[model samples]
Target: MSLLSPALRRSPAAASTSVTAAGGADALPLRFAAVGRSFGTGPRARAVLRDIDLALAPGEVVALLGPSGCGKSTLLRGAAGLDTPTTGRVLIDDTPVRAYDERCAVAFQEPRLLPWRTLRANVALGLPAGTERRTGASRVQELLELVGLADQADLRPREVSGGMAQRTSLARALARRPGVLLLDEPFGALDALTRLKMQDLLLAVHRGSPTTVLLVTHDVDEALQLADRIVVLGRSGEDPAASVSQLVPVPGARPRDRGSVELAALRSRLLESLGVDAHRH
Candidate 1:
């Protein structure tokens, strides 16, 4: 559920995600209906995903987890309309997604910033196609402040640390004021301390903005810390394609204790589901 443009916008009254304080413009729901994706044709055909059905409630934060190469990114691409599903469809609220959906914004693992642009200018690139100059500038400034990049707004990509660049990427995505903020391993490259700080910052961002978020992450603890629910994807037995294997709703509340005993138990269970030995790993 990622990437934004000038697409669908919904009323705050319709939003149900309460991970933070609600905002003026709330989130829209996203649904994957019997979706399937395959590559090649005839004898060469290989399915990566089949019958992937998941619904994200308005304003909720859901994290996607799966084994490597289990089509996690592929499914996300389908929702973003960067790639089409071979069957079924992805819908935002009641509308089917079009190419490069404007209702969502994606912050990938890489910052993907243009070296020639200042951080402010990079963020401004996400403004809607028809936005007035003044309004867009204001929005970009607000996002820079939101992501704690206001002081460095004048810097270029080469001038900042990796974490700073990632923050800029987040600010750029939010510049679209997307209904659904899609995060694809956005903190995977950072150091442990930086990653933790970015997680806290994300919560702050959600508290201030109150948009629906669909995050795709490989970290089990990350899923436990931030998500309202964790949806696990995996193949069953010898099945070639992956489908939903578990839908575990996270317990407790936001800003959860990182070392909670309950979370530890859940983490072990999740690791086991992914075929890792809890004690050995």
Candidate 2:
């Protein structure tokens, strides 16, 4: 049986109920309703996801976790409207996400900055066309400073370290002032220290702007630290009808201590769900 039953499928009207059930009326900032995605058709078909029902509330961070090819990123892309779903819908603020808009932005694992452009220009690139040059410039400057890249504004992508480039990508995403930010392992490639720093930065940004965030990652610790709720996608080759296996609530306050017993237990449980024995690592 699917984790989400037919009756439990989310509807626009159910938004209020879901949020209330989740403990507060304004909890969910984003909602997914019977969302499914597939590529091709029939004989040449491949179903990436099926029956996904998720809710991400403002001031809340949710993580998407699963083994590779389990559609973790595919689901994120669908939510971002970077990929269209063959079935169901993705809604932000109860509205469909179809084409790019200022209300939503995404940052991927790689820092996709233009090699030729300086950091400032890269971030400023997302500014709406016909925006006053002065306003655009000010917005870029503000975001650069927010991401701690103000000093590196003149540097090109190649001139900065991987972490710095990723920060630039983050700044660019934030430049849109998106109400929903989708991050697909934005710090996955950084060194350990850099990764932790980036995670902290992400938390700070989310708290400051109070945007709803959906972070896709395989790292259990990452999810535990950043997410208000952790969702585990089924493994590859599993039934397409499967929904998230577990929805683990992350307890504790921001700037959570990773070495704490609570975090360690959550990490171990998540690793186990992913079929990895924590002791073996």
Candidate 3:
């Protein structure tokens, strides 16, 4: 029996040479080449993504937006090497990503922190294997300070507010010093006000340690505010599979006016692509 599934064996990427993930750069470009994913087999097979091609420049932040079940998170999982694409490939700075690639770190909708660990210990959990104790401690401290959790480092997950716990999660991911940060609705669980604050915190985090960021989100406004480009995933016409339906660039620099006329126009276009009437309440 072949090591690869039949679908992967048919992919050009399947033959790629394996390489170790590294801190080759502070930020690494990510590419998805003709990526597709499906589950099950035979008549039970279901396709979630198809022909999804996207590229992120080093230090660029891109947001994936789509209707529920459009495979936004699936695409992100592929990049992180948490799941393999049925076809095509995911490349990081020209090298194929290995399984459980250390070059990338992921934070999901839930903080997923260990309840018993203090915020500091949770962040320390992401340090690379063999990291020197002193250096790791310094890095953890730096990240806690970066995420505004320095004052609460002793608190366990249960003691902190949801937003604080989420910040701790972000800090942990950053501790790995990954070239790519994959966030799947990291702020989706927070209340509106907390979500807004977290967004700003993320921007600050990016500035302090710029890396390629791939964010999967449902909020059009959040995409406009955080992404350098917004890739709308949806099916076209009769095709029931989702792909990059719209790759819209978010113009202007960071700290954009949330109510900017330009952003509003882009938001409307994105919402309409997802089958929502931009004019509807």
What lDDT score belongs to each candidate, Candidate 1 first? Answer: 0.84, 0.76, 0.85
The local lDDT score (0 to 100) that residue 39 gets in candidate 3 is 93
- Give the per-residue lDDT of model 3 (tens digit) for 4-28: 2334323323333322223233677
Residue-wise lDDT of candidate 2 within 1-281, one digit each (tens)?
Answer: 11122333322234332222111112236777888877888897887778888876554577988888878888888777788878888887777878654567889999999999999999997676687989889888877877899999999999999999999999888776666788998999999999999998887766556566789997788888887778888834646544677877777767788889978877888898889999875
Q: How many steric clashes does model 1 contain? A: 5
As a whole number from 0 to 100, the lDDT of residue 1 in candidate 1 is: 21
lDDT of 1 by residue, 1-281 (tens): 21121121222223334233343455778888899999999999999898988887776788999999999999888878789999989988768988999988999999999999999999999887998999888889888988988999999999999999999999888887788788999999999899999999998888788778889999998999888889999998898999999988777778899999999999999999999898875
Which run of 10 residues does model 1 get worst, by summed lDDT?
A: 1-10
Best-performing candidate as measured by TM-score: 1
Which has the better lDDT: candidate 1, or candidate 3?
A: 3
Q: In model 3, where do residues sit more than 4 Å from their true spots?
A: 1-25
Best by lDDT: 3
The residue ranges of model 1 lying beyond 4 angstroms of the native Cα positions read: 1-23
Could you tell me which residue pairs clash in candidate 1? 3-104, 3-105, 3-106, 4-104, 5-102
Evaluate model 1: give its TM-score. 0.91
TM-score against native, each model: 0.91, 0.87, 0.90
